[model samples]
Target: MTCAFILGAAVWPGGRPSPTLERRSLHAAQMYHAGRVSRIMCCGGLGRNAPSEADVMVEILTGAGVPRTAILIEDRSTTTRENIAFGLERLGMSDEIVLVTDGYHAPRARAIARSLGIRCTSDSPAHKARPRTILRESGAWLKFLWQRMRGI
Candidate 1:
């Protein structure tokens, strides 16, 4: 019973899932419907002036025909590290996990999980995003690489 881990993005002020989040959530839902995974784990935390990202993702997945019981939310991780760490713990460090996120974010997401000693597979929906998203993710990659260089 592999669980699909849907990494959350920002939520709009009105609690809408951000584009990245919606994309990932939809992908997770599709995987569930296709019998690729047994459950979906939505991961994210609250941001300023917005609801928890995980909550938004759970809502989106549920609305996309995924049953509520099939979705689990970890709404307390504001950063990728927190998300991976807390999610791994909540899921009992299961080896059967498929990390879902945008392409640009998958490397770092997978690295973080591996750093924590959790082995799992990954799946990123086709990458199409605003220029801002590309830039932000690029910076994230640099930061992750720099931290690794520094052994942080």
Candidate 2:
């Protein structure tokens, strides 16, 4: 089975999904509708928002016509590494996975998955990265590299 792992993004103050989060969930829904993936796993925890990122993702996926039974929730991950690690542990060692997130975030997420011994592909929504987003992602890349170098 192929699973689309939808990584969490920011949730707005009113419990709404940020545009990036919505796009990621929608892309995963499309993958399911297109038969590219048989299931989806939403990965995230509560941030500054009331409902967790995974909860908002589930709302988006279901609203996009994907059934609840076709989705799995990993609602305790607050970072990319935890997202992949926790989700993979829940999924076991069988199904192939496709990481779904913003383009700027995909590389780090993929690398994290690889470091965990997971060979997976990735897909991202078409999003123009704002300068702030790019800068933030750069910092994230540095942190990821630092963690890898330290074997953390």
Candidate 3:
């Protein structure tokens, strides 16, 4: 099964970028650079206050040597839920999907993909905020649980 799917990286405000974001970039770059994915499907949309995350990732990947056309952008996803729902259709049976994000997002991301019938593994970048990130990711998990509770 050559179905390899790696999630796109992240960007920050001012597009100043984050260490976590760079780790996301490195994960994608390594996958692409290693020839794990023939074409990459970058997923993410603009955050409420930030520019399009997919666009930022695309710029970095292309600059790092992934061909422009080889990178596909799923630029409509505003949340990790959308990342799965929209990303699955965009990818369409990625033999293997490595959900890339900071350490904490792993659980829900896999669950979301499975809900959409997209089986996946993960590729979490080493966290810059390992301790704080755990808390943040924990908070994210709570938010996800709350979203499910609210049925959003």
Candidate 4:
């Protein structure tokens, strides 16, 4: 990865962190404080017309002791590509970012982000999600693949 960006998303059906997503945020925070990246660009938009994912993740991070100033929220994105693109333009982060999401999602997220000329890597943070949730994520991953292939 050239740099780092913490991808945020809506809470899972179960709730905040959703186990797996928590792992992603924790990893992103660790990466940020470990001197691996200069900034943490939180990505995601509002789902269900609720508070934005970026907002939700930032609160979680802050509760974990990450300062507000250290987080950047990209609130207009509704998809992986939109996440990277909106984040890059809105936050003006570095060329490279370590994409954060469920393990099943990292590959496709990185693929889409890099396709947009952004240097990116993967950090799967689904430590909190249960096996069933993971299976759901995997299904979503396949759907993502189909949509990308179909130019959707």
The candidate that wins on TM-score is 2
| Least accurate 10 contiguous residues by lDDT in model 1 | 86-95
How well is each residue in 52-130 modelled by candidate 3, as lDDT tens digits? 7777777777878888877777888877778767777786673566777766777878877766667778776666556
lDDT of each model, Cα atoms only? 0.85, 0.94, 0.69, 0.70
Per-residue C-alpha lDDT of model 1 across residues 13-115, encoded as one tens digit per residue: 7887777888899999999999999988899999864779988887888889999998888888988888878887788864498999888788888988888
For model 4, the stretches where C-alpha displacement exceeds 4 angstroms are 1-3, 12-17, 126-152
For all predictions, the C-alpha RMSD in Å is 1.6, 0.7, 2.7, 3.3
Error of 2 at 15 (Å): 0.6
Residue range 1-75, candidate 4, lDDT tens digits: 344566665566434554544666777777777777656777878776456777767777787777777777888
lDDT of 2 by residue, 35-142 (tens): 999999999998999799999999999999999999999999999999999999888879999999998899989999999999999999899999999999999999
Hey, what RMSD does candidate 3 come out at?
2.7
After superposition, which runs of candidate 1 have C-alpha atoms over 4 Å from their true positions? 129-131
> How does each model score on TM-score?
0.91, 0.98, 0.80, 0.75
